[model samples]
Target: MDKDKSIDHQLRATWQAVAKMYNEQAANYGSTMAMAFVLLTIDKENGTPSTALGPLMGMEPTSLSRILKSMEDKGAISREKNPEDGRSVIIKLTAYGLEMRKFSKSHVYQFNNVVREYVTEKELDSFFKVTSTINKLIADKEIYNAISQDK
Candidate 1:
């Protein structure tokens, strides 16, 4: 099948383009798209658990750790012992981090607004449904299982 007609290829290509756009915006603030993502994922009023951050963002532990370390060094976030779980820590955003979160949120809203302008509501709804179905298929292991069963 042609790559242009492949669903996964289209998704991957669109995501890469979106990532590049976000990274360019983040660069002005001395940040990366990943860092902005982490900033947005963190809880504002209550801190998020360090252990939960990785799974929440679909990120690996090592990568999350490095980002957290950098955020700490930059005074964007601070780590404190989790009272509920001594073995884990809670990641809290500082004033600078809060400010950055706002910036990140604005960019996200702007992206959505721009897309909404071009895409109709029905089209956007269909897009969401399709993506959700794709996620559900993968999550259920239906794709691979069906392939294996066919053999």
Candidate 2:
């Protein structure tokens, strides 16, 4: 099949481009896109549980651990024992982290604003609906399961 005609190819290519753009922007702040994502995922007022962060970001534990360590080294985040769950730790953003979060948020907003300028609201709504349906199909295992069951 031609890559240009493949749905997955389009999705992957667009995401790669978006990631590259974000990474370039993050480099200006001496950070990576992953770190910026974590900064955004974390709650500002109440720290998020370390365990929850992985699932929230759809990231693997090992990768998240490395990112967390780097953020800690940079004083962007601090870990504290979760009061509600003594077994788990909570990840809280320090003052510097909060500032970084703001910067991350602004970049995100700018990206969306630029996209909105080019795309109509109706087009964006359709794009979101299509993506949501794609996610649901994958999450429900309806794609491969159907093929395997037919065999």
**Highest TM-score scorer:** 1
Provide the lDDT at 21 for model 2. 99
Enumerate residue pairs that collide in model 2: none
TM-score of each: 0.98, 0.97
Question: For model 2, how does the per-residue alpha-carbon lDDT over 1-151 read when each residue is reduced to its tens digit?
Answer: 9999999999999999999999999999989999999999999989899999999999999999999999999999999999988999999999999999999999999999999999999999999999999999999999999999999
Candidate 1, residues 45-140, lDDT tens digits: the string is 898999899999999999999999998998999999999989999999999999999999999999999999999999999999999999999999
Q: Estimate candidate 1's alpha-carbon lDDT, on a 0 to 1 scale.
A: 0.96
Candidate 2: segments with Cα more than 4 A from true spot: none
For candidate 1, the C-alpha RMSD (Å) to the true structure equals 0.7
lDDT of the candidates, in the order given: 0.96, 0.98
